[model samples]
Target: MTKRLQLADIGSALIVLFCLVPFYWMIVSALRHPADQFATTPFPLPVSFQNLAAAFAERNGFGRALLNSLIVAGTTTLLTLAIGITTAYVIARVEFRFKNVVLAIIVATSMFPGVTLLIPLLKLFVGLDWINTYQALVLPSLSFGLPLTVFNLTAFFKQLPSELEDAAQVDGCSQWQAFRAVILPLAMPGVFTSGIITFIAAWNEFIIALSLTNDQKMRTAPVITALFTGQYKFDQPFGTQMAAGVAVTVPLVIGALLFQRRIVDGLTAGALK
Candidate 1:
């Protein structure tokens, strides 16, 4: 048993290390002096803040891009969760005509390649004169996020005991109140997990943001990072790009660390009961 546990631990460690390698390299490169940005050293020597400074330089419009990402992604996450939770709860707990068909359609929507929606969405949003607006970014993201959110949250809601809802209703709570009060709180882990996925997907989304928003002020971080250029036209600005990468990733890391406890507790709280 001890041997098996050790092997499992080692496997987990290796997987984590593999995932963190690029992140470590990005940080090291971001901290490196522009002159030594290409050095093969494992550690950054003569560290400089130039890359970090360049990342937020006026020409890059990256700071604004960061705000754009926050607005768009945050809006997308909230809207996705609100609609998804309700939709998932109904699908999971209620009996309705063609319920299976509805579930199938939701899954099928997610499976559709997002790229396929590009031209049609662009034309639709253009007709609405919504180009370069938050809605332009958000609505398309919802189309993709809702299906994943609904499917996952539906499964999570199913696993939760229906007796809880029944008990809530018996106590005179309306169906909506029962769901909002009892079930939602208990499903925090699944909600958080799905929200994180939605946020990251919307945040990292590039092609759609690029294709939809023509203005730099409306562009997302990933798009702005791609637009990063050096002091000279010929320069690659690799260090600055690394710095931007670190800047973009740090918030997500911090957020995960902060919420990881809640997620773990939610998962274990059920088993304990």
Candidate 2:
């Protein structure tokens, strides 16, 4: 057993290192100059700040794109948490017909390819005259982020003690009052976990944002990155692209670092109980 356990630990460490190699490569590539990318022996180092500087100042307007991304992601995170928390509570605590079926449906939605819905969604946005607007961006984000949030939160909520609600009610609290005062507070870990997931999902989203927004002013970071790879330029501005990649990843890293404890707690809260 000890030998087997040692082998398993080694395997896990190898897997983690394999997963991290691409990220490390990206950091090295982002620092190297475009010319150096093709050099006989390219080492990982920033060729020049010029690449990042130029990428930031390029016509794609990553600054505005980043700001728009922040708005869209921030809004989606808040909305998903508010709606998902309630839906999760209902699903976890309420005994009703077709409950398992409903849960299955929610999980199934996450399995569908989001790309398949793009054209249809774009047409819907056009009918609503919402193309190129923030509404188009926000609605699509909510739809994609909600199902996962609800599923995760429902699992977490199932682990909570029913005695808390009963005690709150015994104190003359109504259902809403009990939920607001008791359930909501205790569900913070789940809430923050969901919010972090939603935020990261929105931040890294590429396809929907690319399809929905045309104006550079409305573009997101990923879409703007696409601008670098065009017909005329066989080679993208490698350094700039790397820097932009770094920029995009920073917020997600910070968010995860800040709420990592909640993430672990939320994901594990009900799994064993």
Show model 1 residue runs off by greater than 4 Å.
Answer: 1-3, 261-273
**Tens digits of per-residue lDDT for model 1, 1-273:** 999999999999999999999999999999999999889999998888999999999989999999999999999999999999999999999999999999999989888687899999999999999999999999989977899888878888888899998999999999889988999988988888788878989998988999999899999999999888778768899999999999999998888888888656544444442
TM-score of each: 0.91, 0.91
Query: Which candidate leads the pack in lDDT?
Result: 1
Show pairs that collide, candidate 2: 31-46
Cα lDDT tens digits for candidate 2, 233-254 = 7855766787788888877787
Global lDDT of each model? 0.90, 0.82
In angstroms, give how far residue 5 of model 1 lies from its true place.
Answer: 3.7
